[model samples]
Target: MSMNSHAAIAPSLLARIGAPVRRRAAFLLLMASLGLGVLREAALGDAWRRPVRAEFRRVLREAAGGGFSTIAVTAALIGLGLVSQAIYWLGEAGQEGIVGTVLVTVLVRELAPVLVGFVLLGRSGMVAIVELGAMQAGGQLRALQGMGLDPFRLLVLPRVAAFAVTGFTLGIIFVLIALLTGFVAGSLLGVVQLSLFGFLDAVLRAMGARDFLLFPGKLVMIGALVGLTSTITGLSARRGDSTATLLPRGFLRGVLAVLLCSALLSLAV
Candidate 1:
């Protein structure tokens, strides 16, 4: 075939391949756009007016409150399992001196953020997907626009911001509870001789500057992206999309976002 024929055939072939590819590409494109535009949208004069503020508050409460107990339980379980084992083994190996460093690196820098991200994703992110997706499918978003409301401003901004804030707050809570629980468990198991304060101090001192900066930032950004992916997935729902279709996609996308963000951020620091 001539080069021109090849070029012509390429377009036709691509057209056939584009449907599934384009849907994914569009979802990613929108997710990125929404993540970037959130702050800009929040800055708009009308973005955080009474209605938007109310929604933000409501979402913040729901996302944080719903996951609070889950985060606690998960953190405690991790403490009893991962943290206690690390402490016991390190003590056995006469590496108790590095306990802080290991825990900080594994728990704070890595496990806490990803685990907390999952907690937020499962607890509140799915809820947003369902609610927003239903609105999109029902044309309620367009209906709100027809009534002179900016759906992005009223809905997207508040929810995304709420999720971000909640992410950071819950992350701190998770770390503290996990560390405390682990200390208690270790002390009871006769594996840890250090006082609670000493253990906390050790963990704190083990933290380098990057840990302080990157960990919280990662959690915040992860939270924001969780909300972003969920909202975009939901808002992009096709007319006939049911929860069955929207949910799995939302979950997959959200999980991908969290893991990718965590990996990249860890690498960066």
Candidate 2:
């Protein structure tokens, strides 16, 4: 190909290549705007009317309903693998004094939020994607709009709030279970000699004032991000989108949101 011919074709090639990139960027910006809109609407008391309240309650139940068993199982496993192992190794190293520090810093502060976020994403986020994607595909969203309903107010706000609440709830449960399980395992293995109250005291002592604020805040943010990203993914579904496409997209986005929020919070604190 001559240089002149190549130049003529380059623009067309570039346009084609850039189209998807631009579309993705624009979609991300739209989602960000929608997230902000949800936050704003949720802040207003008037937005918590009967319909919105009902939907919020239903979504909350559906999202967090079976959370106890899942959290318990996951927490026990994590305690066996993470907490017990850390305590045993630290005790062997004669650095048992810092067990609290290590647990708080590594497991409670970091792992708990991320793990709980993933649980919520798997348990409820994918459901949101499927439900909303189906509604979008079936034109139910349009029908609701025609019926003078604001989908964002009715759907997005409550769901996001529920997710946030669920995230915090699960996160706390996760921390307690993991810690207690770890303590029990450690005691059984002869790695922990302290009483349960003493072990808890050590963990509490290791935590600073900032940690009290940061831990819960991290959980809330992780949950909100997962919920927001998944919801946005579903709501943005087009006519061509199906379960296969929406599910993976929502999962990836939710995972990224959870990690990113955790990292940012870690850096900030």
Best by lDDT: 1
The sequence of per-residue lDDT tens digits that candidate 1 reaches over residues 129-204 is 9999889878899899999998988889999999999999999999998888888889999999898889999999
Which 10-residue span in candidate 2 carries the lowest summed lDDT? 26-35
Candidate 2, 149-226: lDDT as tens digits: 999898888889999999999998999999999999999999897999999999999999989988999988888887
The global Cα lDDT (0 to 1) of model 2 is 0.90
Q: What is the lDDT of candidate 1?
A: 0.91
Candidate 1: residue pairs that collide: none
Cα deviation of 42 in candidate 2 (Å)?
1.3
Model 1 steric clash total: 0
How big is the positional error of residue 220 in model 1, measured in Å on the Cα after superposition?
Answer: 0.3
| C-alpha RMSD by candidate, in order | 2.2, 1.5
Clashes of each: 0, 0
Error of 1 at 78 (Å): 0.4
